[model samples]
Target: MKKNQSKISIKDIAQELGLSITTISFIINKKAKNRISDEVIQKVEAYIEKVGYKPNSAAQSLRTGKTKTIVFMVEDISDPFFSSVAKEMEKLAFDSGYKIIFCSTDNKKSRAIELISMFKDRQVDAYIITPPEDFQDEIEQLVSENQIVMLFDRFYRDADYNYVVLNNYGSTKRAVEYLKNQGFKNIAYVGLKTELSTLTDRFDGYKEAVREANRENLSLLISFDDVKSEVGNKQFEEFLELHPEIDAILFATNNLAITGLKILKKKNIQIPEDIGVITFDDRDLFELHAPAITVMSQPITSLAKEVISGTLKLLKRKHSIQDKIQIVLDGELIVRKSS
Candidate 1:
């Protein structure tokens, strides 16, 4: 250690390594691989490491306009599915020298709009959002401004936005078809009523499959907030009572299935005997139930990886719709005894 160089700067490092300030800056910021020789790059890196020189990130970001931060907005951070995906993304982002700021949108338009404004104020490098309804304009504006935006979990079908999402329609259709193949009839889809494309697609899949089999497309839908309320529980019970012929049920989400399971358990309804059950999204409770539940298991890690990669890719491009990336992944239908 040089006693006099206690407060070393980029200028000091540049002078000591006999490299120009621009050269040192390029190397430090990982932007010199093509222009700088490997030997020189290694030497500069070694010197920087030995001197423990850390660039002033605030100043660097001012010059480069990069925060190396990604804001990930989900429907609900407390939900198992969103949290699990976030855990995977956090590590991947850190490894790539970026950090994630997680925010829960709760499927609210105003909240999402507020978050987007915050992202601008904070100079967030990129946005990976699971958006709610009625905010397509905000997204479009961001895209027009040459900002990095990656939509995940759900996206607008009509909009040419960068996104990675599950094949909700296909997966749900397959699950219902599987149940029908196993001799379960009069299957009813229990789903949340929503305009969100993903949820709508899931219901559409269930409807199409049921109709194809020369059966009535029976379904029960409730508000998203009603899933946990007393009103929601009553709707499930009454819906079952109204249609005793419904021998099998496809719950659109884990939360809905959990509520339905409780009602069934209270009534001593034996699964697969009185009624078969299947749901989207696997949970630990589903795996450990009295009769383990059947599920359409989403690729959480794959979703995370794709979003991170897509966000980074978007950052490099013009950040317009023309260069947008789209990914559609499949969910595994894990059959268990409950179905």
Candidate 2:
């Protein structure tokens, strides 16, 4: 009743109402539909509301074997794409009576594995991951144990896991084609050096477009570990200097684009004049830039909805779902002055 008082418990409610704890629990767990009378249910409900008694989640998890918690593993939580998607997913999951724990893999396989094991130890109900390369064995093990798993943003081609992804290849291809149409002759791609399918597809898309146009493929791949470092900036500047013929650049990820943009600015390279630019993932900073960056925007809202819905379906069905689900959503190419 006090401002800083401890939370009221089911036992307290039972004691107050002169009812057994079992009866209170059955009602609280919504298992009294036909077995319990309406009068007793109404009394219990009224008393619960009056006292604001809350059931212990840990105890409930033990009794029901459902923790109602999900782990969302991503490469970088601070990235706008992942963070935006996370916010939406968290809201949806919370509304559906589940909580989400976001963990950044930092594009490290070892870190991802450790987080996966930790979440497993916590008995999380489900997992939504943007997995790193060579981590299929751990995911496969989770699947084998009948754990609900949903891959998002990226996934392994060989693994049969439920996933929600963007059309990486097609989007990047279109972006390149658009740049070509804008009369940019030599377009180069700056991408992360990781083996993520998302980055690979984008790179492949760039290659396809360049090959089709009879233009030489000019691309630079930076290691993920060095992506945010000054060394990456130097590498990108060197790549640009080495390929003077490259009049345009397509960055594979938002971070790469941000880095490239800074380097370009430092060198006084005018966008759309000296080097046209288009990024894969959209960010607010991109839109607010001088020339306003063009980008292949992933459907963050749709991705969140589908991922959460898919995760919920798996959690509800538990081991009943045999076939893996894969949903690939389209990305929109937002044309801006930079391109």
Candidate 3:
């Protein structure tokens, strides 16, 4: 029988250098701080280079009780808005010594719950959740367990958690009022259900905008569970057959707005001339279009940095922040040809 090659262990390194395992482990892990001689450190470093070594993250996490990992749970990764946010977050988190894992729930409550449980079981250092529902008890349990949790882009009035979000109500209201200022009378609202507080807030703003403009006859179209691209196309086709007099549209999210753009192209309707458009979340598609899109642009860079910074602070157990405080960053309305 051929002899098998045994993997090198910290014990082998310690024995070879005539040092204790604890000293070897500490030196390998870069925890050497107890006035160890430079000569011994050099010897260990030289030996480590001679032998190819790989550190196991799981083992290190078990020893230190910190994985230095963050979970970013979003409603849908397919949406360009959320994808951009995730990219920005990954960049910032990586720069700050944290690895980020993304989860796309597709706006399903069950998937959201499953991802949260998996991350918790894996002992993720922190979570930045744009959850599918207002999960108060689960989040509170996380907090009680000394896990850092931060909510982003959505708010639950009853849950006491750290959060960073846009000024949804104010921004949506402003977008509508701007359309009204441009003389759009029959503005319609297109969106999904109210599982997320941002949706509810945007709806509230839409109603407020209509009321403030004294447009009582304005139509409110709610796209129940399905408001995705295909669903929006079918809904819009049916919507036009019934309510063809709508002069403008205010999309609660950018995906709805993009879908609306496609529908308009199909109907051969000119934007801002025949129908005006405004939506939340701006991206290159909206920016570079012929009739450039008007949008409520969230401060993504600032938001990403703030969320990560807040999460890290919580992880370090530095200080207890003000409870139920909503950091509502103002959104800018970038105006172009499409209202």
Candidate 4:
């Protein structure tokens, strides 16, 4: 504890901990989730405390709320649905005098919990989360402490929190109903297997519509872990092989639909002739596909506006609100050559 010690910059801490300056920077700035090991974060943070090193940003945040930063945590940043929403909200948030930083939770409870805990060590003014599995207790804790949180994509059915999501049940139901009207028999559902409400509601919707239409409720639920692996491809292939009667498919997510298309193409299956296809999310590539894939397009612009405006409203009235903000938007069914 010398009075005139030279300023201990990030370099000193980096070398002392045997880690890179970038890693140190990420940890110091509370941006190390999923990229840096938790053990490394602990070691680096402990050393910084031991050396009495304080980042200027940290000090300033203590004075005025960390420059009004918001953490928009979603399942995966690469997903077109989530990415589009983030892009739509970025400028709106900044223009409102707040900064938005994105982090992928990978739909893992452990990852989400870690990100939630990081807010404990720093000042993250608000959170727009597409949460993973069970984290009700963590979310409730945030609300108890007067933190700004907005849940998107899916929500906790048992927990009351502000959220904006699509009409998962109705959207899938209508899509499947349309296919049935078009003489699509044995319609199969393709989607990632998760407890997420978004996918679950879609399945329920499809299931109900198929039940009423007197059609078999056929579905292939791929594991979240296998979304990118060949295992998923094999599963889908096997499902298709086992169910040759399937004449139409309603994919739950964009990536799942992409996988379906690739497999179908390799098998020389013709769209709208061999099988009709409809995906949940809209993307540029979907329309650019050979047959111009059909889709249930979400309200991307409206979603962005709702989430950002809702966040700003929540931020303005941090803790005095009694009622929760809940919004559910409808999806548009865009028919194309594929269906």
lDDT of 1 at 217: 82
Task: Tell me the tens digit of each residue's lDDT in model 3 across 261-310.
Answer: 88889999898898999888988989898799888888888888788877
For model 1, where is the 10-residue window of minimal lDDT? 315-324
Alpha-carbon runs more than 4 Å astray in model 2 = 1-12
| lDDT on C-alpha atoms for all candidate structures | 0.90, 0.89, 0.80, 0.88
Query: Could you tell me which 10 consecutive residues in candidate 4 have the lowest summed lDDT?
Result: 1-10
| lDDT per residue as tens, model 2, 61-99 | 999998989999998899888999999999999999999
Off by over 4 Å in 1: 1-6, 14-20, 31-44, 319-323
Q: Which candidate is the best by lDDT?
A: 1
**Is candidate 2 or 3 superior in TM-score?**
2
TM-scores vs. true structure, each candidate:
0.92, 0.95, 0.86, 0.81
Clash count for each candidate, listed in order shown: 0, 0, 0, 0
What TM-score does model 2 achieve against the real structure? 0.95
**lDDT for model 2:** 0.89
Task: Rank candidates, TM-score, best first.
Answer: 2, 1, 3, 4
TM-score of 4: 0.81
Clashing pairs in model 4, backbone N/Cα/C closer than 3 A = none
> How well does candidate 1 match the true structure in TM-score terms?
0.92
